[model samples]
Target: MKRIPYMLLLASLLLNIYSAAVWGFACYAHSGVAERSTYYRQFTAGSDPRTFSVGAFTVTLLSLIVFIAAVRKLRGWYIAVAIVQALFALLYVWQLS
Candidate 1:
């Protein structure tokens, strides 16, 4: 496409990065000074912040990639994939939040 969806791409990239960060945080965040407690455990234990971030990351990456491909006129269902990916990401963020 003549115009690259920079805004969409940036948003998607940021959201994906945010999701990755949260995922990494869950794996690294400490709950106390005495133990190696992480948000990952908290999420698996009961809370669900990690899930949100993960889902967002997955959706965002997929959307951004597909969007770029579609805009660039790459063969295949790029637009559909992008739509699905973006929608999924939004839903994940919304559900978790």
Candidate 2:
């Protein structure tokens, strides 16, 4: 159906936003642990996971807005966006753990 692409795009948009939110929370939740552990501090030195998550969330949100506006023209690209969304979801989970 002609609506498939639109639906896929919508799904992608939601997935990205959801993943971004999860990462945002993980960022805050992990910050204390990262601060308390010498290993974590050294590993994450010069790079705060919380800040990184916020940046990722912002970028994903902006990308979602752009893709939503151009969904019709971007047809087949929806699959790629979906794939990226999946990867982001996985990354968010990984960050939490």
Candidate 3:
């Protein structure tokens, strides 16, 4: 029961990392246009990358808030996760731009 928050936070972090990676691959990879479009379409189910990025950011923010509110004892760990999440969010924005 108590592990749920931790799991959610971990999932959030992984999702954010994945979103960044997909964005990077789509934007920077030296693949053919058809291949890149196919990859992006498959990964995002036909949605825009920016929309997917926004959804990932929203999930990360909600999960972090829940984790922090539900687990008060792991101050250091939560703080570190928050910082890493922030960095990921920044990276996402930079890549999108």
RMSD of each: 8.4, 9.7, 2.9
Error of 3 at 25 (Å): 1.6
Expressed as tens digits, the lDDT of each residue in 15-38 for candidate 3 is 887766775697687467666666
Q: Per-residue lDDT for 1-97 in model 2, tens only?
A: 5565456556656645654564455456566654434333343444465554455555555555555565655457665774675567456546645
Record all residue pairs in model 3 with backbone atoms less than 3 Å apart, i.e. clashing.
Answer: none
Model 2 compared with the native: what TM-score?
Answer: 0.40
Candidate 1: where are CA atoms >4 Å away? 1-4, 30-58, 73-97
Q: Which candidate number would show the highest lDDT if scored against the true structure? A: 3
Q: Which candidate order results from sorting by lDDT in descending order?
A: 3, 1, 2
Worst 10 residues of 2 by lDDT: 35-44
Can you tell me which runs of candidate 3 are displaced by over 4 Å? 30-39, 92-97
User: Per-residue lDDT tens digits of candidate 1, residues 1-97?
Assistant: 4345556665666665554555557446666532333454443454355454575567576657756755756446655656656665765666455
TM-scores, all candidates, are 0.39, 0.40, 0.73
Sort the predicted structures by TM-score, highest score first.
Answer: 3, 2, 1
